[model samples]
Target chain A: MNMNFLLLLLDGLKGTVILSLLTFLVGGTAGFIVALSRLSPFAPLRIAAQLWTQVVQGIPLLVIMGIVYFGPAIYGIFAVPPLIAATIAMAIWASAYLGEIWYGCLRSVNKPQWEAAECLGLTRWQRMSRVILPQALRLAIPPTVGFMVIIVKNTSISSLVVGYAELSYNAKVINNSSFEPFLYFGLAGLFYFLVCYPLSVQARALERKLNVANR
Target chain B: MSPIVEMRELRKSFGAVDVLKGVTFDVERGQVAAIIGQSGSGKSTALRCIDHLEKINGGELTVCGHALHTDKPDLAALRKDVGIVFQGYNLFPHLTVGQNITMAPKLVHRRSRKEADEIGREMIAKVGLADRWDYYPEQLSGGQQQRVAIARSLAMQPKLMLFDEVTSALDPKLTGEVLRVMEKLASEGMTMILVTHEMQFARNVADKVIYMRDGRVHEMGGPEILSQPSTPELADFVNEEF
Candidate 1:
């Protein structure tokens, strides 16, 4: 309820930061691969990527975390750490959503743009890297930053069932012992806002810049 | 050498809608063949087929010595010898006029940055936009964008160039600017096929005019054919344009 509780919550802050960063890096890469697959010329890759997006999106985040926590143990792969399990579930969750968001962005590029790139004799990857992705990246920044906020907040869900000692988890434990839910939880919310507000501002600034350039 | 492009009954369909039904034509090297037609006459579709943009469902299409009829045509090689400009002026919006022209050249030809910049400046100058190298597509007027688009294609130095109504989206003055650049390319003897509504430009510049009607070449002959049409459909079409 005192300085000790504040210090303990700060210790928990370390895990949340690490978990969020790892999740973003891992998920962003996987999501990009998934988005490309969705747009792949090969039919099977496109179908499989479509299926992955649908199935992952349909499941609840809590269940996904639970499955990651216990699903492996059923197959004799036990002792997966809470943090690692949470990271996997979070990544899987973020990939499907980000993949869909980005696929829409990429496809939104004008059809003639694709034809123009192809007609220029660029290899497939060259067209993507030099033309399409640069344009799509502009459309993607706002939603992607918005999703990072979701990712930060979603880390709290991991603590509920998987027992990961992230920010919200330690705050909950401290409040349980001291019976001071208002101050600790309020402080936790403040920390969450502090982490996410700068990202939102940057996204808005980038979006404005892109719009002005487009204008 | 064989003709730069030979289309014998080339066919294309989109979900039971036959866009190019047995379309046939030939374009010789250094020949400017203007394809004039209405919206549904499949001129753009046919132009796109030369670069394997749209697969021909039946018959033969050969461009720059590559047969385009096969299931797995070497599109990369074919495209290397071909460049296309679209009605929408599909210049990469994120890139400056200079970069838009130089990007493919740098990637495909692997030229040094200095050489690429030289190519960019030269091509941009050829298109009469030498001063606007740093301008982005959105910054340019439609006509200017179309000119930049032409310059982008010209930088590739393709054996054949296809313009699918390059000036269709521009105002008369802007279209004139774009047409002037294209006229310079024609004067330079670049083999070109253009699907255009500009009957006057076609009459003046095209060596051969293919007046397409209903996905078929209704009339084909020298530029003189534009003034004296052999078919009622072409005469009507040309009359409407004038």
Candidate 2:
């Protein structure tokens, strides 16, 4: 209810947004590469990518944050910032899930399309870029937008280990000082909803629009 | 003159089953050859092997002067000279008909956008879908989509075209439209090889007819071979409703 409390929450919200965007940008690029490698013709490359996804998905995110934050110091590089450490951990976590999601989307493209492109004499890259990727990207959009909500929520975990001071962290601080748990926590929840609701709506809209078979 | 496509004792096996067992055939320049047979007779497999869509296990195979029996054939160059259309009409659903037709010419041939669009329009007109150039594959009927698919292949100016049951998915009315376009291509002196169920189209349009049975050329001759098949397999295949 107080101005100072509101300002603290808003400041934390900014950090949350920045962290999510940065993690997604880094993670999304890495995920795309992983997805391509999973589908690569070479057995070793595909196995390597598959191993990465399996290992990343197997570990917990909080543990990943701790290791990333502390793993550098074990090597005698002690200058690692909390924000950088948290971002690195979150990115690794996200790329595994996103890579799997995108790999499924890429595979969902009909087999005949690949054949058609092959018969046209398009190179391997051309078949992917001109035919396979375009269709896969359309199918990928809805799930990708839905994944953004997960990214926004997951940023909160960074605050637990590294104390990155995102919305949840600030809410805990405000509640401890004022002893008004309901007010601060409710306000934090509202901020999270405001950030995530639009993405959910957009994802649903894309699912309907891209469902061309029914149309 | 050398044939556009020549297969001498070509063999292909999927696991334990042999699909194309020592199939021998030739498709000459400016000739239309139709391979007709019952299902599972390897007519489609033979067509796919010509485009190098299916790798051959043994024997000699050549298309557009490129030998395919080698470990590393120049597939890109071979494909550039050869075009293929499938029964499914695998037009990129996300792209418009014009975009689909112009993709190869622009990318593979490196044609300018203006030149590609010009070629797109010409091929679209050739298939009687000039007005539907901007439509997506899903927006068109099954037959129209197949026509657009044909145009997409034709835009590359291939030396030879292969069609694998291209009209098998269509109703009789729609099939007529597609067969008419193919008939026109035959009259224009374009070399083509088609695996079709439409015996009437084969008799009317194909200069040569091949009847495949159990992965071999059972009977092959001029269009009259349909009416007067020398072998019982060819006679049974020609008389069947499929």
Candidate 3:
């Protein structure tokens, strides 16, 4: 309810946005590589990508943040900033899941499209870039936008483990000072909704547009 | 001149079941050969092998002077020379009809956008779909989509074309429209191999008719073979409605 506290939360919202955007930029690039590796003809590359997704999916993000933030200290390198650690941890975690999502999208493209491209004598790279990826990208947009909402929400997990001053962390600080869990947490939830609801709505709109086009 | 496609004792198997057993055939330049047979008789499989869609277990296949029997065949070169159309008309659903037609020419053939677009328009006009060039595959009817697919293949200017039951999924009117396109292609002296159930079209348009039985060429000759009883298998196949 306090204006100062509201400003504090707004400042924290900035941190959340920065962290989510940075994590997605890093994660999305890695995720694209992971998705292509999962579909790679080379056996070892596919296995390595599969193992990465499995390991990251198996571990909780809180644990990953802890390891990323603290594990380097045990190796005598303690200068790792909380923001950098959290970003690295979140990028790794997000890439695994995003990679899996996109892998499914790439595979969802009909097999005949691949055959058609091959019969046209397109090389492997040409087939993927020109024929296959263009189609897969269309199928991927709705889910990829939907996943951004998850990424934004998941940034809060860094506050719990890495002590990153994101929205949830600032809310906790406010609650500690005011001893008002209801007021602070409620405002935090509101801030999250403000950021994520638009993404969810946009994702749905894209899905409908794609379906109509397909029809 | 060497044939566009030459297969001698070509054999293919799916696990333990042999689909094309020692199938031998040759398609000369500008010739349309129709391969007809019952289901599981390897007509489609043989057509597919020419495109390297199916790997052969034994024997020889040479298409456009590239030997396909080798472990590392020049598949890109082979495919550049061969264009294949399936019964499903597997056009890229996301791209416009013009984009679909120009994809291979622009990417594989390295044609400039203007050149590809010119060929796209030419092929679209050839298929009588000039008005629908900008439309998506989902917007077109099945027959129109199939014709766009034919134009897509033609844009590559392939030396030989393969059709695998391209009209099997079409209604009678749609089939007639697609068959008419093929007849037009044949009249233009495009080299083609078609695996078809349309006996009448084979009789009328195909320069050579190869009747396959259990993966071997049971009888092969000109269109006259359709009426003559050179073999009982051919006679039975001709009399029966596929």
Best by DockQ: 1
Q: Runs in model 3 with CA error above 4 Å?
A: none
Ranking by lDDT: 3, 2, 1
Better of 2 and 3 by DockQ: 2
> How do the residues B1-242 of candidate 2 rate in per-residue lDDT, one tens digit apiece?
99988999999999999998899999899999999887898999999999988989999999999999999999989999999999999999989999999999999999999999999999999999999988888889999999999999999999999999999899999999999999999999999999998999899889999988899998899999888888887887778843
Task: Give the per-residue lDDT digits (tens) of candidate 1, residues A1-215.
Answer: 49898888887788788889988988889999999999999999999999999999999999999899989987897868898999999999999999999999999998888888988888888989989999999899988988888899899998997888999999999988988888999989888889889988988888898777666
Docking quality (DockQ) for each candidate:
0.90, 0.90, 0.84
- How much is B236 displaced in model 3, in angstroms? 1.7
> Candidate 1 docking category?
high
Candidate 3 lDDT, A84-196, residue by residue in tens: 99999999999999999999999998999999889988888988988889888988999999999999999999999888889999999999999999999999999999999
Task: List model 3 lDDT by residue over B31-140, tens digit each.
Answer: 99999999999999999889998888999999999999999999988888899999999998878999899988998899999999999999889989999988999889
Candidate 1 lDDT score relative to the true structure: 0.90
Which regions in candidate 2 have their CA more than 4 angstroms from the true location? A212-215
TM-scores for every candidate against the unseen true structure = 0.96, 0.97, 0.97
Better of 1 and 2 by DockQ: 1
Provide the DockQ value for model 2.
Answer: 0.90
